[model samples]
Target: MSNTPSLTANLRSDLPAALVVFFVALPLCLGIALASGAPAFSGLIAGIIGGIVVGALSGSQIGVSGPAAGLAAIVLTAIGSLGFENFLVAVVLGGLIQVGFGLLRAGVIGYYFPSSVIKGMLTGIGLIIILKQIPHFLGYDADYEGDQSFWQVDGENTFTEIINALGNPSVGATTVGFIALGILLLWSNVLSNKGKIFTLIQGPLVAVAAGILYYVLTQGNPTWGVAPEHLVRVPVPKSFDDFLGQFTFPNFGAITNPTIWVTAFTIALVASLETLLCVEATDKLDPAQRVTPTNRELIAQGSGNILSGLIGGLPITQVIVRSSANIQSGGKTKMAAIIHGVFLLLSVIAVPTLLNKIPLAVLAAVLLIVGYKLANPATVSAIYRSGWKQFGPYIVTVLAIVFTDLLTGIALGLVVAIIIILYKSYQNSHFLHRVDSDDAAGRHHVQMQLAEEVTFFNKAAILRELDGLPEGAILELDVRKTRYLDYDIVEILENFATKARDRGIDIEIIAVGKRVMNPPSYMKFFDLAPAVEGH
Candidate 1:
């Protein structure tokens, strides 16, 4: 059977998935835009391009693209540091660099990230989603919806914001939050299994429709009415020209600036990593377990961002949040993603007023569910059981991301992974054994076989073995399994050879019968001869 299914084969499934994703993505786009310090419509632009442009170009069957919450902090800082127009230039430049990465096959870098770290990233982002959304969930939305940073622009940290949310809650917002949350939980647990009709209507969409109704009905009661500030705010163009005028053009003249290039490279690097990571994660969430061609995904993302930047949109990436929602909603093909994009574009133009009626609290409740799925305690326990080598990086990554930012947390995890590798190399560099033979010679044999690859890090262990040998013994230095021996170890062997006679020890060195690799320059610089002798 063919791996790729016909796009129209699953329209029954894809259509509902598309509607569900459309509802899920709408608030996220607006929220990420607000968080990034960009005009809210810019996020919709990115989301639209992500769904139509990237989704159409990508080979991923279930993965969805959008303005990522992970990039919000970067977008916010870049806009402030470079000015909005200059930052748009950086975004464009970043898109070109991403295209280069795709061409160069830099997508393979994603494979190098440890599984523990990747899990940590997902879990970390999940926690960030939960923590950052608490205020909005409670209706005191002083901060933007998708602001994932530890220290917010409002000068309140994640903890302080939570405390404040508890102190001052909005009755309308709080009421909508619980009601929406209840509706989601009920739909997911009970109603979703009822029939086709229930499945077709997504919990999020239903919750949103209910919230909008609640908002309209509560208008007469001031205390329980959701304020305009707590509702979705997509710009409604006065006319066609006004709609076109919303997009801000990049300042191409700023391309020559060094700061612009630096910002571009940073955005390119970070966005690419985030995209690749999400690709891996979304594949796991796929029911069919279909794989995404990551390099092609990079190209699609590059193209989308280029278009998005030209028309004033936040940078786009394959976002796990929306992609997961799409998958969980039973999205079958790229068509679902494309349809969601079309909906986004049409909604702002045709029914911005209807979307504006959605209370932010309802969206927060929806995200809270998604956040919980990402950071499930079961997932954390499974990671812990994978042993310290995996857990160390995983836990550190989670903590770092929770306390700091996404990039910093991953950096710390990578460092821990390297440390684990080095420690294992140091401990497992060689095999040591003792042999007592009842031969005519009556010789006691001590054998030490070198690991497949030995470097300077193993020198101390080799030296300690050599120094502790008995006064009269046969020491077998086995290099038969060694692929490459370091110069430092060679020098140690040579020095020991000179002292072995005085200590009444006879040493025999063994190397592979196959041809030996010539020593590196470092060996020659040390003037140490190879201790290997072919059988």
Candidate 2:
């Protein structure tokens, strides 16, 4: 088991990683809100809560939590149906429900998920990222700006949106986007290998800087300059008072609404699942392959959601986008997570105006790269190599996620994976009987071959056969070939052996090592009998 290290080492590893996470998180915060039809500030609040509150409470060193794209569609529908004020009440209640889940110890579900499905999920998500970011890269904003669905935003569906964006392109935005893309590609592929300058400066950072410079050069011009429509337009609060004025409070009065309760439960369940999945996936990506504590993560997420809801912010979870960025950026501890939160808080206060200057196109370019990496072909190839048992579930999960919404797709994949597991278990639990008879009394012998390993999954099959044993039968359990047997099966066998002795049935064991049957001195009378050869 891995132990949590000292605070000093954590700080040293986390600080720099947090900086990278901050950069990755900023746009996502804004984009998710835009997609969900919520106030852009809501996303920022969620990010802050996810980092400060969730980060502090979570057991994961590398998992970064924040507003998730997966929840955007749900949030959008809930707000529209329940009204924004009432929806917020549900969000608060949702956090409370998540706390309940932690208390119930429901976090272990993550462990049962098939490895194939999980791999497929990661690869599918990566592909979606690449596809969704294309319009933004081309300066063609077809969808509601931050949509993550496979279908397009022009009310035409995903495929149509791609076509429409291609049909109509904004030259100025496209040019800036292409330039940014070129710079990113060069920095990642070529520049990083050459010198210290390349090593120190990331491609995304350079693309953003170049974009801002381009905007500045074309500041006064009408045709060449980046337009306001193409820029990231955060609410510009003029002063500290104005900024404070932007904060919205939840409608505590709506707490009694049944609709509020339903939405709350929905948010809590969906958010918790997403967080668990992301934590699992992020851990796999970690160079160290560290396992995060799922229960602790639930507690942290619940706390963050509570804070976010209280502040009239969006619900949050362990977001893979920022978490992956943290890993890639060489983050080593939770300090990076805390620092990223601080950066979010400071940026809104100290450099709100500067942030406002960044073109949405530039951010789009950054996301395009992030998305491509998530859904890359290399990931698919890797999954395929892990064997069909893993690949089958993985592919199913990927397709489900892509064709439908995230939660629905995951549920489908999980069910399929579970069925496969049960089928394999049943196939492994077979008993073969070979009988030889030559006398007038019709004497016969039976031999049962235990599986290579027996587990609880095979208990039913073994039990059914043992319960139906015939009278005057000679039973021989062959353990010479069995390497390991689960304690559950062993206990059952012991009981059956006692019953067989009572029934006057002949029972014998083969190759039973001394280590197999060391009864307690108190129960010496019931001590295990020795094995017989060819009984």
Lowest summed lDDT across 10 adjacent residues in model 1 is found at 514-523
Q: Which portions of model 2 show Cα errors greater than 4 Å? A: 1-16, 151-154, 219-225, 431-535
Instruction: Give residue 493's lDDT in candidate 2 (0 to 100).
Output: 76
lDDT of 2 by residue, 1-535 (tens): 7466654676645665576577668877888898888889999999888888788888888788889988998899998888777788888888888888988888887787666766767777766666666666666665655466765334665566667778876666777888888997888788878986775656777787888888888886766677767777667788889898777888888788888898899899899999888888888888877898888788788888888988878999998878887777667767677788988888888888888777767877777777677777787888789777777788888888777656666778888888788878876775668676723666456677776666778888888777776766777666656555666777787677777767665666654563322222212211342332211
Best by TM-score: 1
TM-scores, all candidates, are 0.91, 0.80
- Once fitted onto the true fold, the runs of candidate 1 whose alpha carbons sit more than 4 angstroms away are 436-444, 513-535
Distance from true location, Cα of 194 in model 1, Å: 2.1
Per-residue C-alpha lDDT of model 1 across residues 1-535, encoded as one tens digit per residue:
8789788998888887888788778878988898899988889999999999999999899989989877888888899899988999988999999999999999888888888888898899889878877888889888877667688778998999999999999999999989999999999999989998888777888898899999999976889999888888889899999998888999998889999899888888889998998888787778898888889989999998899889899999998878877877778999999999999999999999888898889988878887888899999998889899999999999999899887788899989998998888878889889986634677678888888788888877778888988877887767666667776777777677667878888766555443222223323422333443211
Colliding pairs, model 1: none
**True-structure RMSD for candidate 1:** 3.7
Cα lDDT for residue 169, model 1? 91
